[model samples]
Every structure is written in structure tokens, then in C-alpha cells.
Target: MARTTDGNPERLAYNDRVDRLRRKEYRMLKGTTYLDHAGTTLPATSLVTQFSHSLQTLLLANPHSASASAPNTSHRIVEETRLKVLKLFNASPEHFDIVFVANATAGIKLVLEAFSGHDEGFDYYYHRNAHTSLVGVREHAASSHCFASDAEVEQWLQDEHSFSGDANTDRPTLFAYPAQSNMNGRRLPLSWPAALRSTSQRLRTYSLLDVAALVSTSPLDLSDHAAAPDFTVMSFYKMFGFPNLGALIVRKSAAHVFDQRRYFGGGTTEMITCIGTQWVAKKEKRLTDRLEDGTGATHSILALHCAIDVHDMLYGGFSEISKHTGWLAKTLYERLASLKHANGRPVCQIYKDPAATYGDALTQGATVTFNISSSDGAWISSWKVGQLASSKNIHIRTGSLCNPAGMACALGLSSSDVQRAYASGFRCGQEADIREGIPFGMVRASFGAMSTLEDVSIFAKFVQDHFVGKGLLNVDDNDEKRVKSEEMRRSEQSSTPSFEKPGLRLRPVRQQFWAKFGACIPFRSRRPDVVSAH
Candidate 1:
């Protein structure tokens, strides 16, 4: 990888190199157009090969072993991987502790469980645009609220006393928001967490930054730990495309709070008695030792370690990948936003923040979510778009994308309307695509390090050929059938030449995100983590 220069030719050359990398490491993507990076990045060939090689060579045992003779190889890999992760975010080990988990949702659950141990029950304030996982935390809070607008959050930041009454001053407060909207690829204010932490609030406040979306394409700089969020959660698979791992990056200053969590598992305990005495001791010496419940995912952790190296080698870190994907997204956005039916009606409804998300490198990542409209001005179901996409060998995400608040806000659907949806039997993953002429979901295509301009073009063409002016008349293809190999792809291409036109112009509509709160939530109280008397 050569130094990135501010020249078009260099960028083109870099993109060519990426194409070559795709040819070598991502042959699995040969016959298909993969646009579902948000669901999971396509695993690279070298990642699997290297991971297998490492497993064959290393004798990694469980991190905790009763036998003194067994080596702590697993522990070593976990710690090294932690340090590498810290460095990835410009965080210092001294300032932050990494706790590996199954995935991002698992990390959020860990935080909620830890916060539940507070003596005075924690107060949870979330932005309305948070993911469904973040929404679950309110179930454990003493009180919960959703901030519907930035004005509401600004008001809270300016006057924390406005939120916390004198009677509830001692309760710990957890403010959670996603760094980017998983639903619409809307990059939110990275400045909010720092703002929340520095506020003059009577309650003990902590910020939970969900970077599961942001870290996939952009860098999260924690160089100034004090200015960073208190707890950051992410899935390693989002960035590395392998190992299906996640981490909770806890500010070391806030490390004591998690120690209070009441639950303790096998490896988390230093000592415990089940037969004779009612006593237990937790391994509180190190952060990882205290939090990871069972035997750690040793093999996955090794793959995670390899993934870090592989990503750097393949894409030259997230900075370069950011620019690469951003350009593609912007190009796609412009084209999609320009699409129109023959009757002069717009063909797509794109949900985004035009000022903040599009081309604002600091505020946006590479994701686009939109819904198509028929030539007759009727809304097309995202489910139809998704089905057509699959039949055309284009992989995309459809539906609400697990952001209920964002979906409600985007569609202007009230609580009663949501209830009506349920009344109409609109269950998750069901064919409740549209009801009463209202759409329930939008199509989403996220770009990754390996995603090229061709992927975006193919998706745009798919939308144009099947949608635009033609309604459901072109549904003759084998639904969900794939051209598995290059030979099959060539045979299909030679047999049926695509008459698909290439164009996309998603209707530009601004939307705010990364905040979800309710007026008054009757939150529950859970047992707090055990506090140390020493």
C-alpha cells in the first residue's frame, strides 16, 4: 500500500488495487452482487486460510486452567487482541479496558447488567434513533426517557437539573446513542458523548456509544480518553469480516462501576463454594478476567487477531477504506436521487440527513436506505425490492433493520399506528411490508472495504430495471436463485442479456437520529453488582 495522495489517478490506481484484492481474496463474491455489508461483511479468503493456519500451529488452551502445567496461551492472545483493538481506536490500555463478548448486542447487555447493580437504580436516557438492542436497556432502568429531537438533548445537556429531580440525585444515569444510525446510515454527532459527560448534572452520568455501524467504515478516535464516551461497544465482525466477535471498551476511570454486577460465571470467579459455605470471590485483578463469563472464545479471538492484520494489509486501514466507500456512496446517492418514472414522478424515497450525512466525512459512513415508488405514485413494498434484488443476485437488507424508533420517526407512524400494524399481523420477518398504503421498511445497501463501484451500479440497475416505470410485471426470474460459479454466470449472461437501465435518484429527505427517549417510562429495578468493601 503506497501513501495516499490527493490525485485522481492515485485514487483510481488504489481502486484498481482493491479490485485486484477482490479478485484474489474475495472470489466468493465472483458471481454475486453483495450489498449487504451492514448485515455482515463478506469474509475474505485469506482470513479463513490464515485463521486455520494459526489454529493448526498454536496449542491454545482455555484461559483459566486448574492444571498449573497448562500454558496461558489463550489469555495472551486475548490480551494482545485487546491492545490491538485499543490501538485501532487510538485508546490507551491505561485509560480503557476491553471486554470481549459474542457481538455488539452482547456488549450492550453486559453494560445493562453491570449498571443494574447500582445501589440507587440507574436512570436510562436514550435517543429515539437507537437500535433495538439499546432499547432493551430501558427494561432494567429505574426510569427511562427518549429524546425525540436534538433540541430535547441540548436542553438536557445544558440543564441536567431539568432531568434529575432533587429526590433522584444519587441515582446513576446512563445515556446511550448510536454513533451511526444502522437503519439509514446516518452518522450522528460523535460530540454528544463528550458533551453529556462534561455536563453539570447532579446524577452520576455515563455515556454509552454504539459504534457498531460507525467502526465498519470510519475510525473512532479515543486519543483523548476524557473526551471520549464512557463505554463504547462494537462487533469485530463488522470491521474484520470474521470471527463474529465484539468488545466493550470501558474507560478505566469507569471500570469500578462494572465490578458491581451481581452475576458471576465460571471463569469470572476467583473462588466460590456450592456445598459447604455460602461464599464467593470474583477475579477483580484484571478487567477481562472479571467480565468474561465462561471459558473465553479462544479460537475466535485468534481469528480476530488475524483479522486485524488482514484488514490492514487488504485495505490499508479504515481511513483509506472510508474515502473509498464514501465516494461510491455519494456517487450512488446522486444517481439514485435523480431517478424518475416516465410520468415524471420520483421513483424512490431516501431517508437521510442531507447536511450532516452526505459527503460529510466526519458525520457520515457508507450506507444508503431507500424505498421505491411505482410510476402510478403508489409506494412499492421494500419486500418486493428485496425479493427482486435476491433473484437478480444482489444482496441487500430490507425492512425496519431493527431500529423501531427510527422507522416510526421516518414514516411518521405514531404509537397507535404501530399498534395498528401489529393489529394487521405485522410480525417481524413477515410479509407485512405495506398496510393502508404505508410502507413498513426500506431497502438498505451498505458498502465495505471490498465493495466496489460495480456493486452499487448493479443495485441501482436492479432498482431501475424492475422498478422505475414497470410495476410488478417483470417478476418472471427464479426468485432467490443464484449463479453460483463464474461458468454459470457466463452461461446465464450469454443466454439472457440484461436490458436493465443504469440509474438511481433517491428522493432526498432529511432525518435526525441517534437519540430515542420516551416522556415517562416505568422502568424496573434489578439487583446491582456487588460493591467491594475493601
Candidate 2:
């Protein structure tokens, strides 16, 4: 039996399971502490071993081969992998079909291509907090809206506001949003798809969910097909960290939306006449065959199978993995939240949902994003922090995170201000951050099922050893707090919620989680005179 860190049934089999997983399968993490699981988890040796064994013993070839001697297992493997992916998500094969793609971005493009085939191009609506992949879809829409808040989206769904031309006309519509924010691990409402379907019957709406980040730790429950999104996309590499493959899960009920896709590729067609007048007859039997443009990634798909076996063998199930990673996220959040300077200033600024708690699987994932600060409240360069952390062999992710809207929202950046900065010499990967004082990016420390308590402690200590106590301040005290311009101040006011903003929900960090850990990671001699901005 795996031991629990908190001596609770909910956290059972997590600590001991991952501790063993690290020593046996993940020997690469022995010397270094990797906290960038949000970017990609470390691929385990067992996964590679199983995959290598299959490659050495078996003959696999392209499924599209016309030769009779070409192994028949490739087709079987492709079909089995689809079933495996569907089984992992708890989606019924009767109602759902998986289409393999290069990555999540490619899946998104396929859906957009399908939507563009309509008589009138589809209207696109996406959450402002979405990843750049979702944000880029606006270019293909007949009309689009970047909804700033849930309230605005709900109102739009109510038919009170409309972005498409002639609201009365039945123009096809698609709403894209991430299951969890890639910038931070804030889990958005999973109920949005069912809610979109309940709106006025005069229009048609489809939901495109990007679950690339969500499935990293938790299982996506598609048990209720009626409530699931029309189309969902995710990368397998984000989950098991190998092969670099992704899939698009299409609800058969909503598969009609894809009939508009005009282009068909090699294996997708039944008959093609290029000599005479060009006429194409596509394979209409399966949605997967219709959209998958070229030969499938057979070896990568087999690797996914091996990954699933190793994942199941080690963590037991996604539920257990979820519980393990969630606890680590909450614990790490608490530790980073506890860090402070000698003069009572916080060492980090964590960005999270005020209404959501960390330990809850529904509200938050196993990722935490924030920027570091000086003792005098000056913004520390997030990229600089990443470099220093890398020096200590504590790997982490930093920068805009390919989330421009979330970056703008969190960093109090206005459209004009960011534009002006870019108009100047400011650019991505530049040493100088935005403006004269604003941070160039934010920092992220994410957890995986293989992550142990030692990794978290090492990371927290890395932040403490470098940023806490004395001699860390480089900027003048007067220049610490930068004066926000009028536009920037207004953006910040709208971006941040009021304390009394009705939904002020919080979860208490379990006492056992802290008391048990306090003995291992020691605090500095000088206690913080003031509280952190929790």
C-alpha cells in the first residue's frame, strides 16, 4: 500500500507511488528537480522500454500500404489506439471518434477548416483567457468576439447580444475555449457546452474545447455525451511526454458540422479523376478517415499504447494521479505563498482564480504561475528567475507562455501600451521586459504524478536561497513600485476582482499538509512581520 502524506484516504497511494515511480522509471530526475510539467512531463524509462521491445520484436508499416505482405498490424494498431484514447477519456466508441493529427494546433486548424466550408463562414467566439492557438482562430471567422468574462459569454449565449451578422438568421457558430488556462492552471467551467446547446433554436452553436493542458493530470469525463463539447483537441505528449502526437475527439452527434470541409487527401478519398474534369468522391463512412489527411503515425501510436500501460502500472489510474498532483499543487502554492523578505515584502506573486481553490480537482490543475518580486515590491525579471533556477538544476517555464490575453490581463497591460512597447525595440526573447518597470513574463511551477515531495522542497528552497533575506535588491526603493498610466490602471481595475465580489470562496490549506512538511523544509530565522497577499 502506498503511504499518504496527510494520513487521509483522499490522498492515498500518491506519495509512495510517485516516490517509487521516480526511482525506478524516472532515473533522469535523480539529480535535478523538474517543475515544468505544464510544458511537458518527463518521459519514463518504462515507456521507452516497452516501446523498444515492440519495435525489436514486431514488424509495423504504414497502414495505407497496398502490398499484401505489408504487416496488417499497423491498421489494427491504429484502430486500437483510437479505442485506447477513447477508453482513457471514458467516451463511448459508439458516440465518439478520434482523429490523429500532428498536435493540438493541427486539430484546431482542421476544425476551423471544416467550419469555413459552410455556406456562410462560421462566427467564432472564444474566451480571452484561451491559449494563442484558440486566439488565432479569429482570423478565419466571419465575425468574432474575445469574451473578457464569463458573464459576457453567458449573456451572449442568452441571445441578448450577437456577433454574427443578422442574429435572426441561422448562421453556424463555434465557441473555442480551453478546459484549463495554459498560462495558469485555472480550470474553466466544463458545463459551457451543454449551456451553449440550450440557447435559442433559431441558431446553431458548437463548442471546441482545448483539453491539451487539462488531461496532463486529470481524466476528462465524457460519460455524458449530451453534455460534452462538439469537438475537443489535445496532445498525447502533454500527457505521457512522447511521440509528439495529438488527437481530435469528435462527438458523432455533432460530426455533421464537419461536412463542409472541402479538401480531401490521399487515403481520405474513394475515387479521384485528374485527367478529365476534376471530380472527388470522399470516404464518407468514418469522420476520422475523412479528416485525417495523410498516413498515420504508426510507431508513435504504438508508443502511446506503451505509455498507457506504463501509466496504468505506476499511478494505477487517472483519479489517483489527479489526487496526487492536486495535493502537490496546493502544497507548493502554500510554500510559495509563505515566502517573504526580511522587510516583510512577498517573494512571489501568484496568479490564480480567487473563486477556486488549489486542492479541488474541478477548479485547479497541477500548475501554479506567478512572477517574483524584490523586497521593496519591485518586479523581478521572470526570465532572469528562470535562468537562475536553471543554474540550480531546478527546471521551470517562464515568459508570456503563448497567452497574450492572459498576459495582458494579469500584467495590467493595455492594448495601446503593449503596442507602443512593441513599436519600440521591445520584442519576444529580449532581455528588457515590457515598459520601464513591468516584468517580461511570469513563472510557472507545475507538478506531475512522478513528482515527489523532495522536488517541491528543492524548488521552494531554490526561490528562498536566491531571493530571500538580504542583498537581492538591485532597484531603488523609490523606483520599486512603478506608477501605472491611466489606461493601464483601468485595465488592472477590470482585470482584478474586488474583495467583496460576492464569489469570494477559499479553501483552507490542510493543517496536516503543512505540519508534516514543516520539519523537512526549514524557514528563515527572521519571521515575516506582514502577511502575504493570499
Instruction: Estimate the TM-score of every prediction.
Output: 0.87, 0.86
Residue range 225-323, candidate 2, lDDT tens digits? 988999999998889988799999999988988889998887999999999799999999999899988887888899998888888887777887888
For candidate 1, what is the lDDT? 0.75
What TM-score number comes out for model 2? 0.86
Q: Report lDDT per candidate.
A: 0.75, 0.76
lDDT of 1 by residue, 415-502 (tens): 6666767776564433446778777777888998898767767777777767777763344444424422322455455644322223
Candidate 2 backbone collisions, by pair: none
Runs in model 2 lying further than 4 Å from the true structure:
1-13, 69-71, 160-170, 471-532
